[model samples]
Target: MHPPDAPGTEPCDWSWETAADPDEVHALLTACDAHQATASGTPAPRRRPETTRWLVESGSVHLLRHTTGPAGMFTLTARPPSGTDESVFPPAEHPLYLSRLAVAPAWLAGGALVGLRCVRQAVETAAGLGGDTLRAQVNPDLRDTCSLLDLLGFTPCGPASADETGRRHAHLHRPLTAPAADRRGD
Candidate 1:
């Protein structure tokens, strides 16, 4: 993978791996949450270990790591064509929800480009899953993630509201591919 922000000639050999074991996936989630909490100075609300395990069992837990170690991760889930309430999300025949995404500050240190690349990977993954639209729920308080999503073509779809944890969140949507005619600079 390209380290979009690395200086000239700097090698950025990042990789993606699917965590096959529940225990391994749990450790990855723990480490990622710890890293995010430390980096953002906001303790992430702890998620149930069973929930993490369930995600792994569902075959959605994918890991992103640099040559050195874990750099980022994300999980995806399919959305119904009709979607949820209109006040919350728009309709789409094929959509994938970016259920969770987190990048370690060490990776961000490379540059915003690193974060962008990771998110783009998520978009590409959605496209591969036959998704036409990609959806995400971003907590307004998480400026870094919000910024990254906005920079990568995701647009805010609605106003902010409290999630299950009562934390305010804004919905974001991104089209998986540009129209064919638009690709040629039409």
Candidate 2:
């Protein structure tokens, strides 16, 4: 959780909790999907309960909220470098995958810093897990999201690929450095 009025630009009171309730998490995910569909005018593929369970079990499903209410959510998962990642990223660079990040339309009104907070959390979590790279697949249709990732130091790699949901996504990676807390500047 972010302390109230941290060194950032805004004075938002941001908090987060690891999603523990299955039904509650499901409803949150559903709301996020609906929000995305309304914004894009196209429904994003829904994840099954089993998939959500796997995420909750193997990683952390975070529910991000502000002073207003639930603003967004993101999932962070880390594992040893796999097939392509093993080759693309260094062998010692354990990859932390960021997935299912969605910010409600209303939250976007708070400005781009909201999205940056989510990414910062993901980066911090990866560094905590001894991960060397933070990896994610961005849907090409999401121009704003791609631009945000670009601004946050993520670099695109290779071409697009289809996931199990058949959605084409462009892979991106950001090499993780030391924790922000360890830095001198607040």
Instruction: Give the number of the best model, judged by TM-score.
Output: 1
Q: Stretches of candidate 2 above 4 Å error?
A: 1-12, 41-43, 57-59, 79-92, 109-112, 163-166, 178-186
Model 1 lDDT tens row, 95-118: 788856766555555554555666
Q: Report the alpha-carbon TM-score of model 2 versus the true structure.
A: 0.73
Instruction: Name the weakest run of 10 consecutive residues (lDDT summed) in model 2.
Output: 80-89
Q: How does each model score on lDDT?
A: 0.69, 0.69
lDDT of 2 at 144: 74
Clash counts for all predictions: 0, 0
lDDT of 2 at 95: 76
Cα error, candidate 2, residue 103 (Å) = 1.4
Model 2 lDDT tens row, 1-186:
343344652544668778666555666677766766566565476568877777766547887777766667788876421233434443334777888787755555445356677887888888888887888877766777888899889988777766676656677888887456667566
